[model samples]
Target: MKTFLFRSLFGTFFGAFVAVVTTISIIYFGSIEQLDSEMFLRNSLGSIFCGWFFSVSPLYFEIDSLKLPTQTALHFITVTICYFVLSLGIGWIPFSFPTILLILGLFLIMYSIIWLCFYLYFKNEAKKLNAEI
Candidate 1:
């Protein structure tokens, strides 16, 4: 619980920092115009919550009773829902069916790639530990 809270706080602050930097950089580079203060705060808070949830998302996998696939599915679903909502709230994505589908496809691809990397890395680590044993 303590670890989870710490991770959440760290991610929240980290997300806020990244949000500020990224937003400012875009504005500075002429990629986007400066947002009014209210929109800026809304977007920043959305991103902060995103970071907090994502940081502790891996904890779902820590449940020994659930199989890996179940854990993955749950984590994927929860993250996707939260992120889609956040993106809409932050005005990063529009509220439309086609755009939502496209975004969902992108999320699927991203999640698959990340899951594969973690799976491969952990398998390698297990092999190393077995060899030592």
Candidate 2:
């Protein structure tokens, strides 16, 4: 019970931090220009909530053996690929190599930081729980 509660709290905090960072990056990069203030806030909150959900989803599986680094890498790759494909489909952004690479690079860096923090927080909590045991 204690372990679960600790993990949940840490995960939530990590998710929120990641979301804030992501939101800031998007705004800084002009990605949120199409969104009004209210929409931006809502999207930011939603993305943060989604991040928490993604972070916790693995718990249902074998989370104990999860390789944080590998998982983070794969997550970044998957997101980048998806965004690239989506941009191509929507024609919202010019499908130029430089633009795609820039967007993917920025997102990858931001998300990597977020995931790294979550992984560290979770690892620390697990260590504490093990010590208690």
lDDT of candidates 1 onward, in order: 0.89, 0.64
lDDT of 2: 0.64
Displacement of the residue 117 alpha carbon in candidate 1, Å: 0.5
Highest TM-score model number: 1
List TM-scores for all candidates, in order.
0.91, 0.47
List of clashing residue pairs for candidate 1: none
Residue 15, model 1, lDDT: 91
Query: Residue 67: error of model 2 in Å?
Result: 4.1
Off by over 4 Å in 2: 1-70
lDDT of 1: 0.89
lDDT score at residue 84, model 2, on the 0-100 scale: 55
Q: Give the TM-score of candidate 1.
A: 0.91
lDDT, candidate 1, 37-123, per-residue tens = 898788888888988989989888889999999999999988988898789877889989999999899989999999999999999
- Model 2 C-alpha lDDT per residue in residues 1-133, reported as the tens digit of each score: 5555666667677767876776678778966555466755655555455555555544533454657566556566665565455546545357888987787778778877877787789899999999999
For model 2, where is the 10-residue window of minimal lDDT?
A: 55-64
Candidate 2 local Cα displacement, residue 108, angstroms = 1.9
